[model samples]
Target: MNTNPFKFGTVVDDEFFTNRKEEIGKIHSILSSENHLILISPRRYGKTSLISKAIKALERPYIFLDLQLITNIEDFTSQLLQKTLKYYPFEKIKHFFKSFRIIPNISLNPLSNEVDFSFNPTMSSSVILEDALNLIEKLSTKEKKIVVIFDEFQEINKIDKNLDKKLRAILQHHKMVNYVMLGSQESLMKEIFEKKKSPFYHFGYLMQLDKIPYEEFFDFLTERFEKIKNNGSGLSKEILEFTKLHPYYTQQLAFNVWENLIKNNSEDIKEVILNSVITHDNDYERLWGLLNKTEMKIIIALAYERKSPLTDEIRTKYMLGASSTVFSSLKKLIQNGFVVKINSSYEIEDPFFKEWLLMRRAN
Candidate 1:
């Protein structure tokens, strides 16, 4: 039996990773120059995978922190300190604690053989954040370059409004550390980094990740399916079109197809698609519940047309009510990640959701 080669809902290593050659090279070059980078994409566009691949190509010391897992400033500072100490040399760690005037008791996890440092909780959040910044600066003074990756960095906005300003102030002067801030929320990331009034304005080279090219993805799927000796003929194209080349969904659909193919030699792509939607029915139902009626109509219109909903004919046909309502609903959907603005048009972010909506309309 061939093991399923597709990976979804997690970061895939180079073995299963398909493309992004240009992105990897560009990111590597940016880090090599000790420059900061801001990578933006909608969720599941493989921002994390691209970063992980790029980091593997680099020879520098690096730390990757997922801000989504961090709830507040205290969590951020503690994780920052812990990851820093974990990656830095033991002697340098000792120097770090001494220089920062912080004492942490060290413990080792027997199962993972991982060392963890726990510091006293006497310091304020601001103080801890400042000290963490200081630690990065001090570490940068060493000969080796260090790279720091903040994944889902827009989550910082949830922790504190001033956190961006404070981080920018400290990071602006760091000479030795290169930073890559990855965010899946396009609007928020742009506001944080592109808006002139924001503290992180022009903070780094801004790069937006687009969906994987159709040809590239198709070739990858075809090759992997063939390697497993599975008769995946015509399935790759179907999966790509159905998933709209969204990385996560493509992998997920492909995974289901592979499983069905193995179990029953079933090549019914549409069945796999239906099963996938049905599996996530509850989550989709909850997502639908979150939107108001106007928003729902806009999404339905977009799902049906897959074009600009602001057009007169589309508005009339969908009974989108009024121009102002359409505009507000579209804005809300885009901001809330239910819809995405593609080139010259808008699309439902989740292709399966689009399918589900179409099925509902037909019913």
Candidate 2:
């Protein structure tokens, strides 16, 4: 199947596109040293794609675990063990695990060819995480540097209230392997790594993944779109410029517009492109429903106006009760991922969503 040049809804591997040479370089620098990294970005900003791509460029044997899959401590332990074993020699899989004094239960599923190991602790034992790190450390000691990328690291907070600090202390001591913790939720990720009182504070280098440049992304997509159509219906410079303003919309818009053009065998793509944008705007009804009445008012107001930090005047103008109410709603919107706070000002993060809000307010 052909892949969209502008992938909005999913993560893309390094092979799928161009650009990000600088990001790859930053990651390379982090791995070159003994330090770990905390990668942060808003949702759908390509954090996962960047790190996965960086792993491919690195020389080390790497394990990429999406922490979203982990639930309890046991699940975390099992996934780490499985990933560590993936790098081991085929003959060493079962036999080598027998030596882990920390892990006790070992069962093999012949059908799936996956072995499971469980660790049983004596009463009053409290070193489960340390032992697990030691197991990974031991795996890394065998002439191979192991780089573990924990995607959506913030979600681990949901696993155990104290698990974040527990894992931090273990990661702080491990010297044999490189770790990269990645998360897209800004507030949670920041609270994990930025607070000095937190266990992970200053524990790793910081890498922020920004969107691709407009012109560069435009040229890349234009070439791809032209090739895919064999120049039957080429993207005009106007449409390309519109795409650059909204990164996520670019991919979704291109997908919708190109699909229609190909289906109808039409040489003119403008009408279909406009219709795609309008359709995307109509999808904002879900966002409106998710927010409360006051949030809806502030959101609609911000969609039409507002250029600075929301103040008393802005709050009154929006018909919100008070500055605190407006501030609370804005905070809620940001935390809920409906909008993003940038430079002390909030803007809807998704381009299509913003367009949808504008249309709804207009109506």
Candidate 3:
């Protein structure tokens, strides 16, 4: 084959997307109804891919944006309006701008002929944000509820301190649009919608995503790997075992394995993993540089097979300092997303990063 079958590092769809049948069905149902949805999960669990696939399947007119890439309120308003413009011709939507409290400056992309919308920096962001959101509701057809997706929705507060109050005030009355708020940061997302003091408390149905099940993921790997040369030798099982069914890492490891197999006709799984670790060494190093002394100690201790980081034996062995310091480091790591608490124990979120740390410690 000229191209690899396994895909990662981007939104997966069509044949590349896998193991979200139930999720897609639920999302489709949610979008079909009047209620909005708040979907939460850690990073790289294929949240965007799942949402995109469902929206595509819905066949409804939609507008999409990722809040992570958005800078502030004006940017939010302009980008939201820009995506909406793609669904409507300039002439059809030109009149809507007149209703905005602060009308955006509009231009046209010469090649795509698509409209480009921008708001004046001097204008009030809240006014523009409210207007842009209302514009989406106005554009919604009575027969169809336009689906508006906000990826990394937890960052909404960074755009404005009172963004939640303003946004919920407008969204609560929106009957013609279904909103999907995708958040990778679970704690912040929960705080926004679960806290009684929050304006958006109980605003939408909350759904949490987990890693794809092992049985299904193993089957997918086997089926895809079979198309390659000499791949039925339990390598798929080994790959799934290595990634533990993390959708992103599973696809990434499978992609690397396929690349090695196709290029060198080699089935050395260990070699592939080492090379994969080496491939991402610089990235991992950058992440490593961000750690403080205590964080560095805690992560290394975790990588060293210190199952329970706070145990007296483990802490003494690693010289992890005072109990409060170790506890604070662990909390920071979890909040920054370097670590996660599963069941009862804490573990590093990145498999390759853990391996990379181990490799460097050995060297």
Candidate 4:
């Protein structure tokens, strides 16, 4: 049986999971303590997988709730309670949840044999939230501490402005549960945890997941590619070189390259890049139609090896108009996750978008 050695577009785990030894170690160590964790990474950079790996290594019962799926405060409480029911026995926690002032409406999914929870929407949200959160402490024994992971936690404020204050107040008093909160949006996560006025400020140990170092990523790709072809390491370097070790795009490009090698018996990345561009052509077209003219100019300039888009040289060459206008456009791009601010330079978040821009210009 042959399966593609490279994978992307989902949580890469086990063999497909790339190198994040230090990160996993840090997360695992924090999970072992009473302190909570706040992990921030750009979308698809493998923060979820890192947390999954750490929890598996720790060999503890865990509950995962993605706040992105949460529609409101009631849904948040129900989702957390649902995952809790799956991890802990119903009978053990039945009395605890049943005693709530407003009892949760529980049902069993016959196909999956998992429980679902819902509460009366008419009840106060904060009280419902407190009851759901208390399940963490109730289910834990002295020896076995549970891990509750919240992914895309930046959505808390959107559910209700003061939900953060309420959640922080409840979570601070828990003794038997260790929380690991993960968020994708850099700016929002920063504001929620880094700002002085935010209730969640400094509530946990902060960590930012970064691009996999080139040295480690290069070796990872080379090892897998070599098994598929002789001296595949040389060819594999092109994937990293083109991706610049961006975690998600590196896997995406490698997936396409692996497909090219299997079907066409070639290591050439050029054809793969072109085919990828063609595959996403319509999406790029729509994106281009939506982008502001100033943004279009900046993207072109960056694609042309012109770094520091704010600089006078780039502004002059790209006809980017006033510096402040360029700054405002770039900020918009960054806020929308289209552009990433790296140190003193700015880069398009999607590597394929950058390639498509350059390719369109060439034609």
Candidate 5:
């Protein structure tokens, strides 16, 4: 493959991915102990990419499943079954799912390589999702110590309000398994796992993933870009500094600006990458429109003022309501996975968005 610049969506392995050594070690420690962990960060902080890197380092067998594509409970069941069966011959795992006798007519076509399990639970258990839990329980009994990592865990609450409760019970019963729940929405992930009232509370280690440091990222890109084009094209120290230190934005801006430079066949080295962000204000306006009144206020407030613990005085100054209202909305923003809270203070999660917020303020 022709090597270009490091794109925003590229998931670099342990060797290529720099910084966050301590965070990676923390996640490794959890999985190593066969314990569960909940990874919380707002969107674009590279939650999926980083966790994929972490899982790759694991010595144990692991399966990474994204919940975004799986909407209904039945889809969840079928996908899990398909992934599990994909590793082994259909004949071997066919009997594994046989006992879900509700799907009494289950069969695996050797030629098509499809496992067809036809059984619906009685009306009560069907809607209650007990049958789905039972199916997971049956799968858990296998010899493999399943590392069930659920990405976008916040979506579960939307699909089923009582999903955490149901899954917690089933997961608790399966001792041979470990879970790493990765969520970009810090607010929702926290509400799901940090709140005392939440069933998933204390189910796993509440680990917050912060952005990679600017200096480290600079050094990383310096080395990578040099490898790709030697002295013909490169990023400068000053330009890198102005782009902000957030991971998601840094990657996106760097990728965009880098592509701009490459496509133009010019490496002035002093080109203003901030122009990409400035000229692209419309892109962010659509995003701004998507936010609710409270969210918009918080974003605007944080753009100009970011204080730790987000006091009631600050909330009032921003024309926001009581502290609780701000807190609740902030939590929702965080859980929605597009923002992150730094030591109890909040900021837009994506590097590009943060930079965009700052650009809007300047305008």
Candidate 6:
């Protein structure tokens, strides 16, 4: 069987990745100039992939850290130390330990051939954080330029109330390091970067990633599938429209369609969509159960509405209560990743979830 070209739920490299030329260029330019950047986008919109691609093209020494797995301040410090050591050379590592005034306890694991580093139990979180920041600063001085990316950077807010404040204080002075803070949680990311009261207010250039352009996506799909069969342009366009050109879902739906085409060579798009929905039925059902009644009602209303939900007529037709209630529910939905506000209109972020809601309402 041929390998599925479409990639979902992970960082896709060159072959699986489609167009983001403009995004890559902008990020490169920002980092090359020694400027920090904050990348904001909804879940599954390819922010991680874009970061990975840009890092490869940068051809510079860098470290990529995913803050999603970091639960506390200690984890943040340990991860920073570990990832930095992993990316830098052994001579640089020795230099870093000697140059920093305060060093974390380091140990070597004999069986796994891995080094473990952590702060002393007697030290406070603030002290450990200071040591980690100092290490980064010293390391940056050794290299000409270094890039560090903290994926899901918003998680730091949950780790500690003052973590962002502490980070901003140290990171603002680094002369040779470029920081890329990436987050899928739009509201929290904005709170950190956009709000004037926040510690990272205007900390870096803010870039919001949107869906891939339809023409670029369609061409990529056609070229990939055309090798198997000559006539895939129509089907490629159909898939793009159906998925609304969402990066993750478009790839997921195409994976299913490609499988079906391999088996029968005559697969219908609608049937493939149904199969895809069925495959994700349990996940969709569990997602539905997580929402409150008001959220559920609003999502169902959006699934059926042909116009913007912000209109008074649509609000009345859906019996969506007062403007305040609607706004509150919308906020909750957005924070939980169920909805996204695009310019003047709110949309169900997941197209499959919207279809699933429509099916539930019909029954």
The lDDT per prediction is: 0.83, 0.71, 0.85, 0.85, 0.67, 0.84
What does the lDDT come to for candidate 4? 0.85
Regions of model 5 farther than 4 Å from truth:
14-16, 104-112, 116-144, 228-240, 265-275, 291-297, 306-329, 332-339, 354-363
Query: Pairs clashing in candidate 3?
Result: none
Model 6 compared with the native: what TM-score? 0.95
TM-score of each: 0.93, 0.86, 0.92, 0.95, 0.79, 0.95
| Better TM-score candidate (3, 6) | 6
Candidates 5 and 6, the one with greater lDDT = 6
Greater-lDDT candidate between 2 and 3: 3
Write the number of the candidate with greater TM-score, choosing between 2 and 4: 4
Expressed as tens digits, the lDDT of each residue in 113-168 for candidate 5 is: 67754445542333334444454445554355557778888888665566677778
Instruction: Please estimate how well model 2 matches the true structure, expressed as its whole-model Cα lDDT.
Output: 0.71
166-213: candidate 1 lDDT, tens digit per residue: 888888888888899999888889989889999999988999999999
lDDT of 1 at 62: 81
Lowest lDDT 10-residue stretch of candidate 6: 87-96
Q: Which ten residues in a row have the lowest lDDT in candidate 3?
A: 224-233
List candidate 3 stretches off by more than 4 Å.
109-111, 230-233, 321-324
Candidate 2 lDDT over 132-169, as tens digits, reads: 56777877854668998899898987877788878877
For candidate 2, what is the TM-score?
0.86
After aligning candidate 4 to the native by TM-score, how far in Å is the CA of 292 from where it should be?
1.4
> Which residue pairs show backbone clashes in model 6?
none
User: Could you tell me the lDDT of residue 44 within candidate 5?
Assistant: 61
Candidate 5: worst 10 consecutive residues by lDDT?
123-132
Q: How does model 3 fare in lDDT?
A: 0.85
Candidate 1 vs. true structure, TM-score: 0.93
